[model samples]
Target: MDAHPGTEIVIDRDAGPAGKLAMSIRADRAFALGDFRIDGKLAGLHGQAWRLDATTDETTLSSSDLPAIRQLSRADATRQR
Candidate 1:
């Protein structure tokens, strides 16, 4: 997804398409995604990492959860406030 101008959009090449869309930011991550469809995957809350299906509804992640996410998915945590 194309980030808003002047926004930090982290593209994880190793993550492939999902990696490219995956980011390191926690605060207000929802605002960054303005009604976008993630083909083959439904965006879920933090910690779950790679599992989003019909059962999934909504997901939100915060700064406190960043460390584990970073470990699970490699990316620069430049979005942390």
Candidate 2:
């Protein structure tokens, strides 16, 4: 999905039955559950790793692995390299 300039994208995944893994992405980097926003650009995504700025963060993510996100990730990677 194409996000607006300042749109907030929330990635949520059910952790077993009673818990969840959530991440909010806005601006550049993808934020974890702590609400920390990283500055720069979202490089791409591979498996469950979110490449932001020049660093890669790995987690048990869901949205990043979705078909739409995967397509975006491929585009991002192509542009970067």
Quick one: best TM-score, which candidate?
A: 2
Compared with the true structure, all predictions reach lDDT values of 0.36, 0.43
Model 2 per-residue lDDT at 59: 27
Number of backbone collisions per candidate, in order? Answer: 0, 0
Lowest lDDT 10-residue stretch of candidate 1? 33-42
lDDT of 1 by residue, 1-81 (tens): 434433343334445433343444322323533332233222334445533222233343322233433443333233233
Q: What is candidate 2's lDDT per residue for 24-80, written digit by digit as tens?
A: 354443443333223333434443444343244422333433454545435445556
Off by over 4 Å in 1: 11-23, 26-41, 47-81
